[model samples]
Target chain A: MKLLTLNFLTCAIKTCKTNSASFPLHPRDAELEIVEADVNLPFLKNILPRLMWDELRGICTELGLPELPATPPTPADLIQPSSSTPETTDAAPIAEADEEPSQTAKDLHRVLLETCIQEGKLVCGACEHEYAVKEGVANFLLPGHLV
Target chain B: MPNPSTPAQTYETNHVHTVYEEIASHFSSTRYKPWPIVQTFLQTQPQGSIGADIGCGNGKYLRDKSQVWMVGCDRSTNLAKIASKNEPHSVIVADTLALPHPNGVFDFAICIAVIHHLSTAARRVEAVKCVLDLLRRPCSSSSSSTSIFTSSATPSGPGGGGGDDEGGKALIYVWALEQKDSRRGWDEGHEQDVMVPWVLKQKKEKQEKGRRKKGGDEEVGAEETKQEGDKTFLRYYHLYRKGELESDIEQAGGVVLESGYEKDNWWAIARLR
Candidate 1:
């Protein structure tokens, strides 16, 4: 299997292990932030409430950080998204008469987040096989023994 | 990503924009008019410049321009396929929510008709932020793709409602835009009806009824109301007002060059800061 098969796995394992063992306490930053989701997905900023406390905390812990508080903020608290939202969309056709009756700003916010993140998914752009971005980075390089 | 309609899905790609493009083009010529925006840029875009079309449905804006290296990204793959078939100007298939390109590579970028329909606040705002991120550069950048469009500089093009200056020149901004929408009419004889969004029968009937109610014979305004063949698609559009547009651009680190609204449409030009 292509180590590329474990691209993100490689990144996560690499991150979990230390560089030269001398910098064990150094913060494990994931490779250049995953830019594939919504390249345009904005950073969670001042005005919106916090989103995805658990997932974000998990991501932080995966990179060796303290977990987040159990209670997370909401749009009312203006937490900007630290991670891109998942990507999912509804393509159902809409009749013009059904137009203006849809959703609230908050509801729309959740939907947008759903569209940006590809949680637990690491797809092979070359082969379309689904892998996992377990710890943040995708390690596609499989070892010879595994292959 | 699997189709959003599938059950037990972990990921979904945007499919509406692609279908929307096809449906829009069936009646109107194009879902978005890119030539004016791109041509305006190319005539001035810098060398080795990396630019992006944020909601580049089919990458039309960057299509066929060899000089300025460009990337085209959208939130929808189906729509990107159409852009690939019809335009194919972009080098990558990536999402605008998180552009795959490295930072500060582009000197300029464009996001056309992408925000209003964003369906989410974060993605919408992020689209502009990506522009900000990409436009950031190494010291003094020297890369300014700045242009000015004054009222006098704004070409009337064909039928922009200006003096007939074409007495000496050809034309520009000649394309006409048609807004398309559908209203389902109840057919009492049938229990169910499926009307394609492409069909504008309701519009035809409404216009005909209005014409008849006015006793027909309104030749004066008919010429002005005539649908031009240049318009080739069913248009579904949402426009931002001047203030709304300015705030979004500025918040995303850009200064407006100029903005103009004509023929019930909104247009603006800006330089990324």
Candidate 2:
């Protein structure tokens, strides 16, 4: 029993590679597009939601976007930033401290563009789970063989 | 959520989780603190607490706790779909207004940064009522069954600040959309309310900037203004005082047995009266 236990321990030590970041089984960055903001809302009422307003607006200010509206048009029936369409080639838009998107009074186009960014797809990092990002929809799915 | 399916639900469901990314990033970014609060809450659960994460976003908080049974629910189909995609298990898609389970089913329910997201008072009331309705149960020997409900939120105002409910908050949010007409002019008072978050946000930014100047994490993204400006933002988010919240619990048929701040935000454990 002692010999067997010793042998198992020795084998385990030899097989267990300390660094997992280099392992083939390690997860990879799937680089999936994640829509972080609603740029596709109907024109009239497209400012950020209250939940998103402050954080986004603050970030906008720091990055230099037009100040977002305190109260924005309530476009209820507007099309949600819905869809599974991923920005195939569009780079994840990053907010900056210098660019202003619009000059319209109380307009938040610039801030929306800045506070928001496309989120990365959460693939297995190992399995190429193709989660598509369209209008902010993420589809983390697995192929038949991989499941 | 339906019962366990035959071969177990795999990853072939749905995919978009920017909500998750942003949510995780927001909390991870020091802008939000629900995760830490969740840890402490989890630590104190009495092994057998029937737990549920209201507006769970995706089972992000569902962890390996054999003692606690957890149910994660969110209102957004897009969110639920993404959550379903990323989660190892299936997440139920339902509105906060409707929960497909029996009353008194859970010993505790957690609503994390959820109340303020609602855009109207009616919807907010309905959502709260629904949760309360489910929580109300009959007892064996006692006259009434009991349960607990907990929520975390920030203060509402021109510079709507963030904090735990213990410090008390008056977070204002549109409970629901009342009309489809685009003609009604936006109210200025509401606009003032919006100012609160902006003001609070500015203050937070100044602090963060100061920290960065003093050797804080500069990698923190500083480019949200442009994008956020175009977004229809929250008027304000105010947290209620702990005592006030307990009274709210009492009104809803519960008792605020334990209430305190967790990470500057109010966190309380209240049982139904």
Candidate 3:
């Protein structure tokens, strides 16, 4: 599973349903890999607004990656410095530019696109629910009673 | 620990997973088109957001845009493999009832034509709750970072926000009454809870083997009368009525933002507050 996926997961325990701290499962004993994926700058721009910008920054910090801005980058923030197009680039529109991707865009690309969690365990902070990650897949199933 | 016996659940799960695996390749070819509602929902989302498609048949939603990092998961490995090959998103083999993600993690989620496949009404609600749980909730006051849902909900005004803190939103579609409309030629007699049949295509090798066996028989048996290429597999489904979906969302503790029918399909947009 990609570290990107860990953001959405939480303790599957029924008791944890009302527990506010059941999320952002802490990755423990992780085996990380940086795999090559086609960088979609437009997609990255699109997800910024929807992402838990603080949580994402925390995860990157935990993984020893670059920090994300406190607030997600807006359309104007993402405009490529070399963008010669009259229309500004936002998450939706990918302006054709001769220059390289902006530093922020590159960092976003690395965290969202390249990082993969090949093996690890995500232990919930509140209930101590341990979700095992093996071969890049996290097993979220609880025992019969939990369901 | 000894596992509890759940024959009904086991049988239903096995049946549905098996059918999908059997027809995954064929199903992939037929699922190329993206649903308009889903596309529109995606358009509203911010770029570089993370999302998941539960029971994503062929990862069709992943191809919509690049800004969001989408993951496609299904209980069937065969379908996940096809999705991984066909779409750019990462694919995982996981069950919808118990997703692997931490609670409140996504900006948006898409569960197209997935929930109705659950064998039981209780499970259907559970599935919705599970998706709701995966959405990212709001942080406490001390946190400097903002939940994307809150940011997006800002434009809609305070009252319009889907949920208090679990602002992550979702778009869910299920089998609806329009499928049974008389003009569509579907049998109205079909019950809401019933096993739907999927015709399996015969492999060439199997056809050749059957031909050899037929030559030895003096009379063609009635049991063998089935067309050489056609075999039926029963898959379970619990179709939802017009209001059942919104009711389930409410029952699951979700705040319905908007809901209604589009032809035979019923869709709901809600926030897991």
lDDT (10s digit) by residue, model 3, range B112-157: 8888888778888988998887776643342223334444433321
DockQ of 3: 0.33
Error of 1 at B45 (Å): 0.8
* Residue lDDT tens for model 2, A14-131: 1222322111121123222222332322222212221233433443444354565664434433233324554555764322222222333223433332222223332222223333
Candidate 1's interface RMSD, please? 16.9
TM-score for all predictions? 0.40, 0.38, 0.69
Worst 10 residues of 1 chain A by lDDT: A1-10
The fnat score for candidate 2 comes to 0.00
Name model 2 segments beyond 4 Å from true.
A1-147, B1-34, B85-90, B119-126, B136-138, B142-242
Interface RMSD of each: 16.9, 20.9, 5.6
Best by lDDT: 3
Q: Mark the 10 consecutive residues where model 1 chain B has the least summed lDDT.
A: B167-176
Encode model 3's per-residue lDDT on A29-67: one tens digit a residue.
888888777655555554554456676787778877767
Find the candidate with the highest DockQ and give its number.
3
What digit string (tens of lDDT, one per residue) describes model 1 on residues B98-177?
44444444445666655555443344455566555555342332432211111232221111223321111001111112
The parts of candidate 3 lying over 4 Å away from their true place are A14-33, A38-108, A118-139, A142-146, B1-8, B86-88, B136-144, B149-166, B181-190, B204-226
lDDT score at residue B182, model 2, on the 0-100 scale: 18
Can you list each candidate's DockQ?
0.02, 0.01, 0.33
